[model samples]
Target: MAKNTYKQDEILEEPFDIRHLLRASSYIKKYQKRMIIAILLSSLGGAFGYIAPMITQHALDVAIPDKNFRLLFSLVIALLALYTGSIIFVTIRSKIMVEVSQNIIYDIRKDLFEHLQKLPFQYYDDRPHGKILIRVVNYVNSVSDMLSNGLINIVLESFNLLFIVIFMFLVDVQLALVVLCGVPILTVFMIWIKNKQRKAWQAVSNKNSNLNAYLQENIVGARITQIFAREDENAQIFQDLSQDCRRTWNTAVRYSNLVWPGIDAISVCVRAAIFLFGLVIFGEGNKSLGTIVAISSYASFFWQPIMNLGNIFNNFINNIAYLERIFETMDEPVTVSDKENAKEMPTIRGEVTFDHVAFSYDETKKILKDVSFTVKPGESVALVGPTGAGKSTIVNLISRFYNVDSGRVLIDGQDISEVTIHSLRSQMGIMMQDSFIFSGTIGDNIRYGKLTASEDEIRKASRIVCADDFISRMPEGYDTEVRERGSMLSQGQKQLISFARTLLSDPSILILDEATSSIDVQTEKALQTGLNAMLQGRTSFIIAHRLSTIRGCDRIMYIDDGGIMETGSHEELMAKKGYYYKLYTAQLEEVHKTA
Candidate 1:
């Protein structure tokens, strides 16, 4: 089996940032009325919870001693009212928060998607799709519980704790002080447990992202694994990844386990202390059985809020890591956004130039250096070279897919950076070597180029690329469904559809990057006739490895090592016996050997 090449997950070690939490909460501001109402209802419900114990103490102390059946019945009825009100308040609060949480989540997801659309190509090139997917979908969900219930619980429970403490003091100061002492101990324990669990949850999140990335990569390359009969080997690799995720998840679960038990133990110890202390007071006649019972009730009530608050706080800490991940994506600066004063470009005449342009995907390794070139309006130019010879880079620069690191790329005497990207790209059509065909009908995909394109124009474009022939032969003709990535179609058919889509856009500057590489000889011949007609009165750049495909171009340029090695018409370069001549002859010899 090949060694596992995936890198280990990078566990984030930074301390939790409160700013991310604050920013996440800011989304709720727009739902202010709903949140306020929820908080009010929840608080009122919690206040009603204290009434039952008061009634219990009253019945045992005052009504029983007096033997007042009427007073006992009245107390029972009041207790029922309190319980009923509490339930109603809780129900109403839950309904409001549910809608509030959903709306906030919807807004966040929408903003993230809109931001992704504006990010430059290089941003996507550097990150895995699954990692980004988790931030936008899964991570957002991780924070939902905390956002929906955390704030409401904190508000209602804090009020309950305050009221419980005050009520206990009213009943008996001695027992109240004892209960308060246990709080500091619980606070110290909470801090220690919370910190440990935060780190553990972060580790779990990292492993989850790693597992997602691995799964996505394997699924996309499932065909390659099957072709090589390496299914067992790949399964073993996946098992290792799954085991790593499981181990991290267990670690997080262990930390969570420690939290509630520790709080429960503190509650038990406080109760024991309260009971023992109450006996001494009862012997001294300073507190009656009813007063002691009421004090104990308040002590239990006190721990209820403390336990609840601890759980809410723990959830918030756990969710901080996910919030940070989400905000990190939002914080990424758009490297290629349009200038504030950028103007919408007028319909271009399609003259393109690169003036001493240099570019590097990274600072350490340059892809193109000090390269200069020009393509006049309506000229058809073919760039031919071996792989890694910068032919594709030149075309990319012309289309502004990647901005030049140094120097300028100009179209019709205007720097590309000076114009709005939308207006500029709308007039330029780029069909990459591996075109992406979205899931839709054949006619729908064609109309994707120009959404308002008429059916007549769609058919005309398809006929111009020779795609209409096979398209018409399909069972549903143009209405046939092209499944995900056009997976159901042959390579040649997908490329032809891509061409038809590009042609329908009516671009002033057309870029075909190895566009015809997939078609067979007969299809290529038919495509060439249509391509020749399409090339007239529009500037076009073709990047090709096949020498025969570009023979009719107005000029052929041989590129190597980030520079133009030779430039001339095909016949001129053949006569010169230069780099182009050798490269073309080598391909011709290879063709004859295959024949």
Candidate 2:
């Protein structure tokens, strides 16, 4: 193992600033008596370390002065006892340190995960998954190491330094004072190096996170990149990020190299001066050979604590910055939150209405302009429009995915804002244009719809949505593992599973945002059969591109410039010969020619 040296310049911010550390340690300290035992043991170990050289000096000096073999044997036994006791104390302290650090890491990970669960959908929209992942990984584990071995070492080193100083002064105050003078210079060197490396390490960590983010986004959007023929451009961009990270890491290494050489020079010069001075005292017939050896040993002791302090401070500072980020995330005020007296809803009848709603994501660009609509209980509505026509915004509004900017969205005539989000969300299901599937056993994926759902329920829901046909054809049926994003399954099969998931929930309102846009005609026809049954008595919003999907909807509305331009039954919209007529006519004729 590498020896740790104190870098005076590396003294980081106070360890107490991190509230989580204080809070975490508070629990450990609750077992204050136990920690005191560890502290006592560590102090015992440090004390014994200083006494070893003194005992040796005594054995050499007195064994001859008294011409007594019996006295020499007793001194040898005393030294052995000190070694044995030190070992026992250190072992106990190590165990306690490990236990405390593990518990702290446990609390950090759990609290972070819980906080993430409570965040709204838009919170995830702006953040990258990889950046979030680094917190649970790179940051937490590093902090754990610092808490365990690093903290214990620091405490022990301090005790050792104090013991060495006192022992040195007792034997030779003049030499000890000379050695102490160099400490301030070492401290200055440390501060300069620490600041330089601190900035560099932070840069590397940030760039590493960015690189991971780029990889994650590109991998997930690979299909789009390949279709657009932009793979080479993205690859080059990722390369640039990787190189930037490398540059930062190299810069930190370059500055850190200066510390050891600078410290080494100080150590050599001081040791040389002490050696020459001690030899002169011996020559003057006042000091014994044993005294010089003990003083040299004391000198070795001083550097370890000083050097160790420097190293601990450097890493501690860098690691604290990471903890600061975690605390910041924990402290962020949630824009939407569950009410103090929130009630859980068990059953729902869907009647969705928007009363004079106006909304915008950014303050300057209004997306929904005075939009008003109503769907009676069990009525299905289709929102049709050109791109960026705010078709998807209507579905988002009903689900309360984003709170209305200036209007009220009512579910079953109860304002959604007044109802608990958990209560409102339970009654709604949304299937977006792009489906998501996690890597897990097929059974686990289905159970995600309702976390507490039983195996029988999962199987029945899969069967109702016609997913059973393909699922059974697989080698393991419902037990098959779905690799990342369900890549192992066909696109149609993934869509079927997604449909099965929502079916298991049995939501009162279903929002289908171009749900069938990815599947083929044959699979679409199969899915539509089950979907029709699912939406029969439930209020639903369908954002459709294919005319067939919206044909049976209760009302079909053509939206343009953030308002409903026309709305009626599908047939009624076709009869109007307006925007909807042109869209349906163009799509219908294209399908007819292909047939």
Candidate 3:
């Protein structure tokens, strides 16, 4: 798979799709009752608005000219009452839709996050995390109003436009036809800009995603940027991304801004035409003053909804871009999920076997090819290999982080692929090259391995990994707060804490890849006593560049060229004087030269 990058936009091949809205209806369906009530309230408020013009016509034609002060005062009160009712209904509808919109956003963000968790490492590997973050947070937020209030407004405005037309025709047929002319003019203008507007908004979304991806990457790698004196270059890159975002946004807004003004201009022209036809062309004798006034008001009412509909449609076009991105993430395939009939793996006895396993990250090259290996329960095996020679891939396979391309991995004679991933992985402890520490107390970080673990368990695990020494020397001991990535701790301390975290899980099989690379020789020597004690009666795979560390293991496998080059007790391999002997002697010579 091609890696997704911040330098380019994600290609979306689908054109403006209504199916996006149809699929979104599932989320709306959960709040259908509230949406219906809100719609009805909005329509009711609009109905009140519709009656105001007729009341004004009545006041002018009947009450005011006839010198009936009482009737005039009553019409004033009625209009006030209608306005107040409209305000009340609109307020209530706004509140309901706000709640419904928030709920929909919550549901979408939650589902997106849950799906993201199930995606394989390759999914994350192929894309910048910032792009994923923007979709889950920013893109999901942008669609809330469109999904809720915008949907309701679409219905309300359509009805408002329909009723305005009916009321105009009833007032004066000729004037009504004049007002109707504006509809086609407005429709043509909207159609002309529709595709352009949609595409522009889609560009805006892509640029925003790119900007977000770049921003997040810069923030995370700020330290490295400073170390390499690349701040000026990075800032220039950020400025370019920001400029692209602004450019796309301005283009989208320019298209959107054209919508209302076009409608308003058509509206004004249509109203002027109504007066011209009613008073002069059609003759004032045929059309009464009251009829002229009512129809003119209806003309305003007519285009108001059209203008509103244009704005709503504009919002829909903009938000639909974000909506598609959100749905795309939700629809990402979970390549490492449990099989349909997969059962919970029975408690692992730590017997791990790879039967002719062949694997690759992508199709172009294979990482492991037709390899076979087995480690008996309670054996401590060390894997030593040159970098990128499938050392980490071997341990990752045991955890089923990626399914093998051609063969099976079995645990105690049962195929791991036939069991639940959770069950298989839950029984294994894996400590990788990077030790990530969340922002929390040291105890909280360790307790992540066993959520129900007590303070004693945390301390015990820390002691086992020799993390307790530095932790005890701290001012707050176990309660000392650590920032994200444990910036306050040294690399060795971070590794020690991570080691404790893995040890706290009490996994049946423990795999540590370059686990002690950061620690000094003295600390590594000190850690070995507890490490040896912890390895008793458990199956463990240790990968370390320091060949001195694996000499005590029951067996050592020198892995290279997509298969194990040699396997034996350290002394036996040393006597054989093959690949393992040469590599070990080379490392010793380099160390003595450095000393």
Candidate 4:
């Protein structure tokens, strides 16, 4: 059995890899043209910004000193135009980027959901639902800005840094060289914290996933917890998980906080050195006041983009953890998907055969071994055994829920594995032990069996399964709305609704695995007549521990010890007094004792 809890530390830890980023770039390819246009607009805006320092120097040195009002006025007007153009470019770029990011997010989410639909039952059975959910929702949302605006900003900022350096040198090389000195120092600091920051953010991601998993699990099992009087215990567990999330978040923030201050310190020192050298050493009474002012402005401009780049880098490191998870889910192998060139299954005739099939969920133990059986068209076969004796496994194999480890499962004389899964399962009606009812009106839930079914068709099916009585007595009758998972309804009511749904589908084969276990004895008896009519022209597989329910089946197969030990009519099995007979008598004695 799968474990109920998955610890945070148990999640796989991945090293920092550039390949992840490279793979993510594939999503951006479709919007490359729009991205390029946005980058150009942003770069143009940045270019207008670079011209501001030069304008300042020209006004201070020539326009102001020459007492030329006309030149000064023109310069003021020109500066205003430059600022206006920059704002326009930035506005346009922001709009474009928002569209691109949302599109990328939609595409990614669509693909992830589609892939999830194809994954087999074992994949979900082995992992917590919350872990899978975080990848599809939270993780995907976290990476959207990074993949879209973040990529553009990286390019735009690098260009801004380059242009600032060039203009600084043109004004005066000595101060420019002093500004360059901080590069190596900042580079060393970044390298020192690179691995530490990445690992810390990865821990944060894991902790958050663990918290979500526990929260969802508790919410779903809240009624059980209250019944067991475990509120205090579960609360303590939640607190522990929340504490881990807080601790990891603080650690990651500490590493991220180092970047801004480090850049500021270097920026301050660089500005101070520019003054000392430009005036004391290189100045020597030769440096113009305007030259010093222009270089100073250039110095501030240069460091600004460096700081912005540092912030972008920080975001990349943090969101990379989320990105890895997103791609990891996308890259998960589809273990039970349609084969290449697989043919669509033709109309089913209700013939199912298992040819010496052997199966195992894991390598530890086999669930079914060398099991061979054939049920003719329109036959009703009952499977009964102790828990974990491959009763459900047998019905599940008939539906091809899991591929056989060896041999084959055939339907209508065709190997099921060679046919497309959609076409094969669409014709089969399966009602599991837990009948899941989606949130909708009563009529809508019943109509789920056949999307194109009419209202009359829905009522007919509900009547056949004996669900119409309770449904009609409800306040809104067929129009009554149900809460999520049909929490407002009784377990017996949910089973009845599920039965109506199965019947509405008009399937050629029906498999019921404890479908009526939750219903009261009276209700079960009342529905048996409708069930018998529904079973008349279709092959059926019924799995129940209540021997009385299966006594009327055409054949009863006692499944145990990895194969069928008894196969005969109910009377024949009773005469043999083997496994089936012993189990049936034991159940009767237990029922008598309870009565």
Candidate 5:
């Protein structure tokens, strides 16, 4: 396969903003009482802490000197009480934060997974599976942690800062002015660094998504890559992508790292200024030694926590950045939705028709143009074409994976859009080229088509498709586990399993796209022969390269360049000597030569 290219990449990064955080507050607010209590306790601790040093300073400078041993003892007790209370508050706060984070994560995970289930197949087609998985992991996890810490830090720290300032001003008005003036400047720098760090983190996230997508695709398609000897090329591409991802992550960490140090340096400078000025004021007797000691202690204390706050704010902003990504996905309105009063179609007859249909993946490029076809009830039709001739697109439309741009698709004389998805899809059985064998027993895999299918029904369906021959040969038979996509089975056996799975549905409409492409000639013949029993009285669309298998089909449609160029029985098409005749003759002569 060739590497795919797109004209432009999406700008995945958004400005770090709290509007999304506010929107998701309800999810976190469920633990509001606990969070508030945690913050309240932390505030009480911080308040006691700020007052302890002041009390100690007064006792040291005056109480002890005046032979007031009782006052000194009281101040020491106050310091002990402050530390003891803070320890208790810290323990409770940590526990509550953990619960809040986990709870929020649970809600986010559920919301995202459910939303994915409700999204249309077209959404998955346009986006890579790995990219989706990355969002679920990186963005969602980020939001979960951020919501908890961001809420608590803002509340506790704000209270702590307020208490420190209030008492500092009471001790000496001028010293408070100096610290307040510099505080804004430090805040400005912290916010600036946080914004930049947020952008870098988002960049790493986007690149990591692409890296994950590449790794997933390469792993799942490793066999094909090895067969084509493209392993070396893929390895090199992955190596380059991995390095790019590393560089992006390192850069994000570097900028975020700068935030804390920058705040610390500003704090250190402010503390030094307060102390030098305080010494001069004390010598002038404008302030007492106890007042100077208290003022210096408060200013020094201010720097470390508020400076460490540069980190909390950075995380706060980083969390908000993740918030934007989550909100972006969650905020997308379901463009394709069932009607408000749509009724489930009961037991459709599979009368599928496209009335002069035209369609496109996007506005500018038309992939299917003015095409019309009908699959009558209980009829089998084979569609043949070169790649990009719109065969799969036609089948997708029948499945209503994408609605037509300017035409109507009627199912059993009813517009499909009027019917519910469950009823419409339940009637159709699709065996796609890349089969999905979920992790479960053989019986479970077969029963995926109809959840309510019993073991006997599943076995009977497999027996109809001749899969019982090998299935019974297995150690545990139908109960055997098929881990990691039935790797234990060969290509032909997997195809047989797919056939059996589709048949268990007993659908009114059936579609097989390159269904036998992976099987051998003998097995393909047997599979098709087995299919004959299941095909009767069902509308079917079969797209195959082996022209011989569809000889019994009522009509063979030769699709070319988004339109049907010819349609007739195998013998009728062979007589025409057109595109269908050439396609048929090429395969026929090759088989004869092989014989």
Candidate 6:
């Protein structure tokens, strides 16, 4: 198997941007009151946690030493009550965070999907579907834990760390200073680890995108693989992709896993040194047993938040990579947007004209050169050309799928670029060579053209396109389930359904781009008869493979090398003995050879 591999040299090494989190937070800003309450509750929990240790110090220093049983029992009850209150506060805060995070995720995903819808066709053409899907679905979810737990943890733990430091100094200044030393050391270590972890996560994300793209391609081309008997080869390639993803994911995990243990190790060393130094320097005469115990407890409490912070920081860094990918997609410029003063197209008269238009998908190659043409209302024009000769480009421009690089496309003598795209496209119908039939019943697919269409209208449209005969013969008769992309239907059947869909819209302008190329001879005659009837009194552009199909068209155009080489009726073009003549004769000879 020959595998095409690209270098994964772009590694993420930038420091996590606070602005990313700030932007994400903006979505949930409406719930600020609830978030504030949650943070307060978390702060309350941290404050309550100090009670148990304080009660212990008191019991050991005074109550037990003085043999006061009643005081000891009272302190025990206070200890239990304080710890229970802390648990309740944490539980309530977790609930609030969960709700806020879920709503924020929903808003973000909705915005992403809506933005993708508004993006130009060229945007989708340049990127794989799998990468876009990953950003919308997987990347949005990756930020959930960070938004939910990471946020509340950062606030509450900072307060907890502050309170612990204050109490440590109050207990013993020397021990407090020893505890503070671990802060800088751990902070430096985390900063170093963060850089490595970010790169690892970026690699993992890239690998996942590659794997998704590969899987999607293989699934769509499964039939081709089977036909070529290359299943084993393809499977090997998939295995390689999966292994690469797993390897990168493990690297990220390895770096993240180092965070907690490193924090805990420093914590242990700090505590050990505090105890040893306190005893060695300030003997038993200076520091009381209760004071030593209290200081040790305070030291652990101080380091505990730092340890928890280490875990939260790991999730924060991991999701930052996901946020970068997500925001990058969101920031994609919508190049083809309507002007601020764009007008809504009124009832269309369907007189389309292109004046000296030129277009190039890229700088190196031009798809359409300086071309000019006009189709009067109700005119049926057939565009006949060899492959890659700009026949489809002309139709695409009329529909405003791609704006012309130079010159103007006008409908009813009004520039299309000055009209709202939705209003302009509403009155037009386009059917491509590959008919896209989504998953649904036959009737439902037809009704998609006009959602307000009644059942009778659907059946009538099907009958007009000659699809009703085959549809009625099915087991369910217009109710038959068409699998995804209409896989269950023959090529002819899909084309008929597509025709039915287009015709049901009652469009003023219709485009058929090689629609009957894949259809059989018998189906083509039936389709042509129906189409010729429907095309009456409507502006139509037909791209035909069989030259014989365009004889009835009002005019025939022979396009070559991005220019119109010849234009006339079939009889006139044949009489001229030009490019159209040669093309028609070549096609006719080929048909005779097949016969």
What is each predicted model's overall lDDT from 0 to 1? 0.84, 0.78, 0.88, 0.87, 0.80, 0.84
Model 4 segments more than 4 A misplaced = 1-5, 10-18, 314-321
Kindly give the stretch of ten consecutive residues in candidate 3 with the minimal lDDT sum: 8-17
Clash count, predicted structure 1? 0
lDDT of 1 by residue, 1-595 (tens): 0112245665455565878777887787788788889888887887788767778888988999999999999999998999999999999989888888788788888988998888778887777777787778887876876777777788888899998888888777888898898989998998888778877877888788878877877887887899999899988988988888899899989988987789778988988887777777446666667877887788778887887887787677767767776777887888776899999988999888889999888887777889888889999999988888788889888877788899999999899988998899999888887877899899999889799999899999999999999999998999999898888899899999999999999999999999988889999999987898779889999987677999999889988887888899999999999999999999999999999
Question: In angstroms, how far off is 587's CA in candidate 1?
Answer: 1.0
lDDT of 6 at 284: 51
Question: In model 3, how many backbone clashes occur?
Answer: 0
Q: What would the TM-scores of all predictions be?
A: 0.94, 0.90, 0.95, 0.95, 0.89, 0.92
Q: Give per-residue CA lDDT, model 4, range 1-595, as digits (tens).
A: 1233546453435455788899888899999999999999999998998888888888888999999889999989889999999999999999999999999899889999998888788888888888888778887877888999999999999999998988888888877788899888878877777667777887887788889988888988989999999999999999999999999999999987887787778778888887788789874767777888888888878877876787687678767767877777777778777889899999999899999999999999998999999999999999988889999998887788888899999999999999998898889999999999999899999989688999899999999999999999999999999999999999999999999999999889999999989989899899999899889999999997678998889999998889999899999999999998899999899999999
**Ten residues in sequence with the least summed lDDT for candidate 4:** 1-10
Which ten-residue region of model 5 has the weakest summed lDDT?
1-10
Ranking of predictions according to lDDT? 3, 4, 1, 6, 5, 2
Tens-place lDDT per residue, model 5, 243-333, is: 8789999999899778667766776777777776766744566666787678778887776667656667766666675677677667655
Question: Which prediction has more favorable TM-score, 2 or 3?
Answer: 3
Q: What TM-score number comes out for model 3?
A: 0.95
The candidate, 2 or 5, that scores higher on lDDT is 5
> Per-residue lDDT of 38-99 in model 6, one digit per residue for the tens?
99998888888875666788889899999999999999999889999999999998899889
Stretches > 4 Å off in candidate 5: 1-13, 16-19, 62-78, 171-175, 184-199, 284-290, 333-335
Error of 6 at 423 (Å): 1.2
**Greater-lDDT candidate between 1 and 6:** 1
Ranking by TM-score: 3, 4, 1, 6, 2, 5
